[model samples]
Target: MKKYDLLIKNGVVVTTTDMYACDVAVKDGKIAAMELNMDEAEAEKVCDVNGKLVLPGALDVHTHLQMPFGGTVSADSYLSGTRAAACGGVTTIFDYPVQHAGETILGLVNSKKEILEQDACVDYAMHCCITNLNDGEILEEMEQAVAEGITSFKCFLVYKKEGMMVDDATLARLLIRAKELGAMINVHAENPDLIDLNIEKFLKEGKTSAWYHYLSRPEFVEAEADKRAVHWAKHLDAPLYIVHMADKEGLEACIEAKRQGAEVYVETCPQYLEFTCDVYKREDGRNFVCSPPIKGQESQDALWQAIKAGLIDTVATDHCPFQSYEKDWGKDDFTKIPNGCAGVENLYPYMLDAANTGKISFQRVVALCATTPAKIFGCDNKGSLVVGKDADIVIYDKDKDFTITLDSMHSDYDHTIWEGKQLHGYPVQTYLRGQLVYDNGEFVGKPGMGQYIKRSPKK
Candidate 1:
């Protein structure tokens, strides 16, 4: 019998802090060993990844698949979403299950698990969304939720009109409760009142184009709320994770909070890092509509600087996408458009391209895309290549020339915001737990191959 299940040879292995030539061996779905020269005769199968870069699979901590929003559901289902993730070298995803009023947190989680377990193509965890306080009963369920391995919770400080926003008192209560429970609170930081006022003003003045989507929530609208959330988490001595951080002021608030030793983490998306409000000026601008709409050039620059400075914790794609027809609903009126865009299949490649072009080091790419997210969200088995860790890996062709297009994507969407964008590198193969899921531009994994990950608490 072979001593190992699989052996990968002749590649440069990269981790969060280091990169060097190494051969990786795997057995029983875990990394068995890593050494400079491993005997190929010892393995059941051998893959010689000559001239490739072997990196840990990425963990996208934010995504919305098969979710209902803006009068229609997102285009990608769990299977399609994870397939897109697999194709992009993402081995795991953290989905948000929204708890509407009159629903229990555990109930929503169980229901989502049932669906995901049947269709997911990659491992997944959930960050439960608590939209209804239920007179503190919802907050009471957090302990049970944590016990069930749903260790992180999400709260929207905006979207009050949609009934998703949690009041300041409720947020404070959640921060304190999460602190005691050793859980993390994730917030969508935007001042609802400010957004509503601007929307109303813009509509009355007939400035309701896609550009107004960016105009409605100016920098202050997001910055003020970011500052407020930081203050609450700091004072309450709790861990706070701000999602899709887009504006300069919001980033500055997080930087200051971190400087003062607050457990505040910042996450931004590829859209914010690559594009600015100018996309809103394009005729196809509707495709770029998303919450915390891509900000100005100055804000984009600030985000890149923070990433290099280590202030930004992770880069996740808030991969909630709507079809082009659904987005057209708000073409003349920004309010009616489904608010999301496709990015799961592009997240790793875009970042990898940045690294290949000397925009950032390859090691930083692994940290932002894999290691840091796994650390922050308590995905202990993932994030790095080490002995005894799950063998979720990606083989990248750093010199390959590729272009993004609708036909090249794996998600079930008719349009892509990254269409025509070129990249110097791409993931040629993806492995999940030592099993090949995607290879040579094809998804070879089946639905339900993914297992639900039970995450640990942050405390």
Candidate 2:
């Protein structure tokens, strides 16, 4: 019998902290060995990855698969969405399973279990959201959820009228409890008073254009909320993660809190890194409308510098998608526009291209797109390309380059915000646990093939 099932030879191996040349051997769905040289006859199958880059499959920790909001469902289901994720070299995703008042959090988990079991094309988990904090039964459910291996909980402070917002008292209570339970709180921080006040003011002035949407949600809306959330978490000494942060003030506040010994991690997205508020000037500006609206180039530059300086912990997509025309809900009223954009499929190539262009080192790209997400969310076996880790890997050509277009993409939407943008490289093959699932833009993995991953591995 052969010593290994598969061997990848002569690739430049990259992890979050280091890069080197190695021939990786795989056996029984795990990385079996890494060495500078291995005998070709030791493996039953061998692929020479000379001149290619071998990196870990990415993890998109924030996505809304088949989510319903603003009178329409999000554009992608779990299968279709993870298919896009697979094609883009992402092998694991942590989607949101929202819980409302009077509902059991695990019940939501049970309901989503079948969808993931029957339709997911990649490994998956969820961060339970407390949509109705006053439901009295939820605090107990939160503890049970942690027992079952979901290590993070999500909360919003900006959707008061929609019943998704939690008051400061409730947020503090949740944070304090999460600290005791060993789970982290992921927050959507925006001062609803500021957001609502600006919206009301704009409506009264008849400034209801798409551009006004960005105007109504200025940087202070996110800044004040982040500062407040940090303050409370600092007081309690609890772990908190601020999601999709786009403002310079918010970043600075997080850095200051960390310096004072608060346990906080912050995430920002590609839309914030690449585009600015100028996107609102286009005829289709409504498509770019999302909560905590994109900032100007000045903020983007500051965010990049912070990321380079190691002030940020993770980078995620917040991949909530809607169709191009879905913005029509707010044609006459900017307040009704569904705030989201599609991004999962673009994470890999966009970051790789950033490395190709000298924007970031290749190792930092791995840290942001794959390694740190697993560490933050408790997927011990899923992030790095190392011995004993799950064999989730990507073989990519550094020379391949292309411009993104709707015709070449895989999301369920008819249009993309990244359409016509250029990508410096693309993945040639993607593997999950030593199994080939995507190649040349085709998905070969079946639904139900992806196993549920609890933050702590089941014994």
Candidate 3:
């Protein structure tokens, strides 16, 4: 009888820590072995991926699909988002779950899983999001969520008007308690005072265009909040992960704290690295509208250096996209336009383009997109190209050239923030737990085929 379910040979197996020219065998949905050569006769199916780059499938640690915000829902549903993720070389995602006022975090977790159970097309997990820190019941539920293996919880430091911001005292308590409960805390680090004040300043002079969105949330707003969050983490001696950091100042805070021996990790999106605030000048610029709006060329250069120097840990898509018409809602006022970009679908290729352009090493791509997220989030079986990990892999055509466009994408959203961007290298095949789910331009995975993954505590 054949011992292995599938074999992939003649590919360069790459990971954050190691690379080997080897053949890998997958059996029962887990990597069984990898070596320079494995007998093809022992496998039921074999793919000769000669001259290809085999990488651990990318894992996006942040995404918002079909989420309600600013009077409309994000365009991608859970299934559509995961499907898009698969086509983009992503195998797993840590999506954010919204907790309504006074709703139990555990209830939100169960309900989200129920929603994913019907529609998800790839493996899914989530970070518990706290909207009301004052509710004692919700506060207790945070501990229960950690026990249930949703080990990371996020609360925004801004969005006061939307009722999502947690006060400084509340943040301190959450940080202190999370450290005790063996959970990690993530924050949307933007100073509300700075942003709100700037918004008033802009509107006072009749500056209501999308460009003002960038003006209101200046780099100082991010820097100030990042320093505050880091000190809170330092005070509790707890681990912190700040999401979608937009400027150099905030990142420097993380670097300083790390030098002081704190466990401070920061993530930045490709939007920040690849584009500038100048994008808002375009006619359809509202499609690119997002929180901590993409900064300038100087910030972009600093961020790229931070990533290359290993100061930045993971690269995630704060992927909350709206349709073209939906974005028009904010045409009268940029604030009314929902804050997000369609990016989970382009996350891998953007970074892959960086590698091809010599801005980052190929190994750094695996680290930023896969291994580090799995490690920091405690997905023990999801990030490495080694024995016993889940066989989530991407077969990439390293030299293939393609242009990114809506016609070529799988996202439910009609417009892409990255429309018309040209790139080299793209994933040709994606495997999830030993099953081929996406193959160039086609999605073969079925709804409900994805399973909910419970994380082990890394605290």
Question: Predicted candidate 1: what Cα RMSD to the true structure?
Answer: 0.7
Model 3 residue 416 CA deviation in Å: 0.7
The true-versus-predicted C-alpha distance at residue 222 of model 1, in Å, is 0.6
Model 1, residue 103: distance off in Å is 0.7
What is the lDDT, from 0 to 100, of the residue 260 in candidate 3? 92
Better of 1 and 3 by lDDT: 1
Q: lDDT tens digits, residues 240-277, model 2?
A: 99999999998899999989888899999989999999
Report every candidate's CA lDDT: 0.93, 0.87, 0.88
Candidate 1 lDDT (Cα, whole model)?
Answer: 0.93
Most TM-score-accurate candidate: 1
Better of 1 and 2 by TM-score: 1
For residues 1-459, what per-residue lDDT tens digits would candidate 1 score against the true structure? Answer: 999999999989999888899999999999999998899999999999996999999999999999999999999999999999999999999999899889999888889899888999999999988888887898788889888888899999999999999999989999899888889999999999999999999999999789999999978899999999999999989999999999999899999989999999999999999899999989989889999999999999999999998899999999999999999999899999899988999999999999999999999999999999999988899999999999999999998899999999999999999999999999999999999999988999998989989888985
Candidate 3 local distance difference test against the native: 0.88
Instruction: Select the stronger candidate by TM-score from 1 and 3.
Output: 1
C-alpha RMSD of candidate 3? 1.1
By summed lDDT, the worst window of 10 consecutive residues in model 1 runs over 131-140
Q: Considering every candidate listed, which one attains the maximal lDDT?
A: 1
